[model samples]
Target chain A: MTEKKVYNVAIVGATGAVGQKIMKILEEKEFPINKLKLLSSINSAGKELVFNGKTIIVEEAKPESFEGIDIALFSAGGSVSKQLAPEAVKRGAVVVDNTSAYRMAENVPLVVPEVNNEDIQKHNGIIANPNCSTIQMVAGLKPIKDAYGLSRIIVSTYQAVSGAGVNAVNELENQSQQFLNNEELEANILPVKGDKKHYPIAFNALPQIDVFQDNGYTFEEMKMINETKKIMHDPELSVIATCVRLPFFTSHAESVYIEVDKEGVTVEDVWKELRNAEGIILEDDPSTQSYPTPLSAANKEEVFVGRVRKDLDNDKGFHLWIVSDNLLKGAAWNTVQIAQSLIKNNWLQG
Target chain B: MTEKKVYNVAIVGATGAVGQKIMKILEEKEFPINKLKLLSSINSAGKELVFNGKTIIVEEAKPESFEGIDIALFSAGGSVSKQLAPEAVKRGAVVVDNTSAYRMAENVPLVVPEVNNEDIQKHNGIIANPNCSTIQMVAGLKPIKDAYGLSRIIVSTYQAVSGAGVNAVNELENQSQQFLNNEELEANILPVKGDKKHYPIAFNALPQIDVFQDNGYTFEEMKMINETKKIMHDPELSVIATCVRLPFFTSHAESVYIEVDKEGVTVEDVWKELRNAEGIILEDDPSTQSYPTPLSAANKEEVFVGRVRKDLDNDKGFHLWIVSDNLLKGAAWNTVQIAQSLIKNNWLQG
Candidate 1:
């Protein structure tokens, strides 16, 4: 075996939901680390987080924070990622950003490990973790695309409030309490926190997930549309998305409809491919009532897929229900996986 | 008005969720009822329901209950409707069935008032109310179908627990309380009460709305498929549905994708048609963050539609978000509307 070189890892926004998960994942994964740094926004500085049985103090992230870092895992807001990703890269740290800032940049690779692990090698100092919804979808689609050259995809997402951040999760809890008590529910941080209007997500389904683009699709929907093409390396693939925020707290689920290029593909064919795919769990026997709800997929790392069936009207069309812990496989795990891929493939140096 | 005739009306399954809504709608519409009868299953026969300041005692429905009734609105289970609908018709009363018993019986007309109110005229005795999801979707699609002529429909529903009836609503309440307290959830009803498995609906989504058929689609899905074809009077229309049960108390929302037969049907063109469509509220203004969530559309009678956009890849493909009260427009209001149509068109005497 080759001599192991440990990484000096730093986590940006270490107090956020995805950030906390990253710390726990790095610990659970037993990744080799010479030193671990916890960095957060100014407001979240001075906080203490326990990692690997040691209490680490979170410091304010600044220009000099990335010094002596080998891999910086970022789950900070988009503005923070925009400001610090390049600075970290310039300091010789490879960034696996969990924000949308660098995802579509031509030089940055938007990746789902199962779908495009090779893309990680092509990253220029920084790599992007695709949207939570996009990561689960691309992971589920990778096997299908390899078996039957894809044509089109139409997806509807049932996303958890955790994707909006910890504040939205608290809002869902508070609003649900208010609703159960027959009191007036308050809405502050849901659907889109930065948008002008906020909607209650307790026992309600909001069709908008992110700020809407001028073309009428929300940014989350557009990310799914654009990022799927990039991750699959199929620029001509037809992708459309409708993303909705639900009351769930952890796992995000999607109802996907796809038209494959191959005509003779059956449900068994799709199931066989999905069962054999990396990082996918198939819980799909209809007679046994086997399927994955969001609650069932929570705290798990793999993408859970079920309810695979052929379209009644279109022979080439098939439907699948894909679910995953958005904070894990969708964000933190994918980021750390990229870091691991970099080290394993000896592609760490710029 | 043409010498108003007070008809004798009976409400079957009068203790049910939709049946109670039918009673309220009848009182609100001030339908000239000469006599009112409330009927339920033997288990709930002695319950009391109030209508127009009078407490009406619910009685067990038998074949003889329709002897003096002019119109009967049935929201009972399918077996009850299958047993008594023909009997009520034989006893000289027209039955507007809110069950799925005879929806595709070839002789019965599946009616959505805005889309196919004229179909009520051809009812020999029992006119079928379409499925809750189907009713809202077809009502939203009516004007577009008229303007552009639709060829195909693909819908994924976010249905409230109330669509499963009172027990499901109670289950949601119980499961929610259990979830909030961090206790083990005991789910006795949901996603098909009689199915082998019961999944908790609080903060979770069940992709199977009803029991799975041999083809892997749920009964609720097949209902949407068969009923849409029947209500549209088009046997050739391609339709597919994926029905899911959500945790909301009322209102069913759908993410609908349609292919219009006419070429170059823009979003503005579809919006123009939807603006004038009867019983439809056009709520699509993404710039203003105006859209209909389940909570916003809960108590309303009209079908609330928003998020209308043209698919980027398929010019003929248009996506719509459709929502309406499952108890009102979905079942009860549509049934009441058919009864009023029967009275208005002087087709009451079968």
Candidate 2:
């Protein structure tokens, strides 16, 4: 019989929304862990969090925080990851970064385990998690693409406030109550927190997700466009994204239109592939009024796909609704799965 | 100065959501009404409503109610329009229907004043108003289509609860409050009041907007697809839609992707055309984070368009976000505008 191995695991930004979910998911998954360290910024330091019945105090993350850590999961801001990721890597800790800091880096492998788990072997001490919207989308599309080759994608996202963090979720709650009471909605954080402008996200849809790039696409839209190609290893693919932030607290629902390369692909053919794929649930039955909604998908780890229909005009075109919990599968669950893959594949050494 | 001719006008379904908005718009526009009549179902017949400082008693609509009426606006329901519209037309009254009863009727002209006002002249005593979601989309696209010929359209709508009328709006409000209070949401009206199943719309996205058709498309989705082609006077235009009911109470927003037949169309070209168009407001500015949201577009009559971008890959493809009040420009204002156009163009004799 082979002996089981457990390694020390560390979670950066442990007090943040995604970081907190990471703690819960790690405990729930019963990950093999010899030790666990919770680290955050100076403001969130000293916060106590329970993991697997043990209370751990979040320590201020520094370069030495990774000295004894075998794996580090980062979900802090991009700048924090930019500053601390290499420092942790220098201390011999493999990182599965959940920020956009190192996603497009030439050496780093941007991955969604369901789509491209083998990419973990190419990691140079850092495996990048794609954007929340991109992760669910690619996870849903990977199955269809495998059955019939994919050429183009156009998606419009109905994203939740939780994707922005815990503060944004609180802002939505406060603004919604204020709206119901006929009080003026106070907008402190939304659309983009660090951006110059702020908009109330309660009972409204904000077309902007991240900061706008020079090309007129928001950073979130560009991430979906670029990271999708990188993760799918298809540089020639045509992808476009419109990322909008809605007032929901959890889960993102996307309306995706794709053009497969092959001809004679019916809805059933696509459904067959999706049903056979891992980490995907097909909930489409028009007769029964069955489909996945954001509320139904909240807290779920697998991506829920529904509203599958072949386009009336184009033989290659198909539309799908893809949904999942932004905190779980989109970030925390995906990050933890990469670490598990790393350990199982014996690819922890970069 | 020419003395404006006043006519006897009747408003059917005066107590409903769109009906109430119609009253407000009629009073605000001062539609040169010599005598105004309010009519509704027998259940709401005795209710009192005020219009322009005049208290009016609602009367039950019957076959003979339109005896001397020069114009009648119908918004009660499809069954009411199906039964009362032809009777109203038979009694020397021109009917502007805000229901789906005659939208696709071969002889009926489904009209949006900005896009196809001339279709009003072709009306045979009945002018059908386009769907709320369709009205905003076509109004925003009319200019772009005229400038660079339109070939195909793909749209995903974030529609408000009010589009389904007052009951659905109340469902959203009650569900929202219940959700906030940690109580179970009782959803009796949503997605479609007539559909078999009901789902809560508070803080959630319902992919099904209306009852599903056998083709895997909802009735709302089919409305957008079929109405766009009919109003554009192009039978060969490729159109596809996915309609979703969101939690908001006022406006309908659409993320539209279109392919122009003409090549070399730039973002500025599209913006210029939208700015010059009569019913569209161009609010696209990436640097200032300027774009129209549902809350911002509510209660306005014109269609607000923003986030216009040429597709990154397809030269002829463009993406736009279109928004407007589902009641104002979508229903009440557009219906009133058709009546006004009939009076102006002297087409009431049809």
Least accurate stretch of 10 residues (summed lDDT) in model 1 chain B? B341-350
Cα lDDT of model 2 by residue, B1-350, tens digit: 99879999999999998899999998889898999999999999999898889899999999999999999999999999999999999999999999999999999999999999999999899999999999999999999889889999999999999888788888888999999999999999988887899988999999998888989999899999999999999989999999888889899999999999999989999999999999888999999999999999988888999999999999999999999999999999999999999999999985
lDDT for position B291 in model 2: 96
C-alpha lDDT (0 to 100) for residue B172 of candidate 1? 94
**For model 2, how big is the iRMS in angstroms?**
0.5
* Residue B207, model 1: Cα distance from true site in angstroms: 0.5
* Interface quality of candidate 1 as DockQ: 0.86
**Cα RMSDs of all predictions?**
1.2, 1.0
Worst 10 residues of 1 chain A by lDDT: A341-350
Q: Is the docking of candidate 1 incorrect, acceptable, medium or high quality?
A: high
TM-score of chain B of each: 0.98, 0.98
Q: Give me candidate 2's TM-score against the actual structure.
A: 0.99
Q: What C-alpha lDDT, on a 0 to 100 scale, does residue B59 get in candidate 1?
A: 96
lDDT for position B289 in model 2: 94
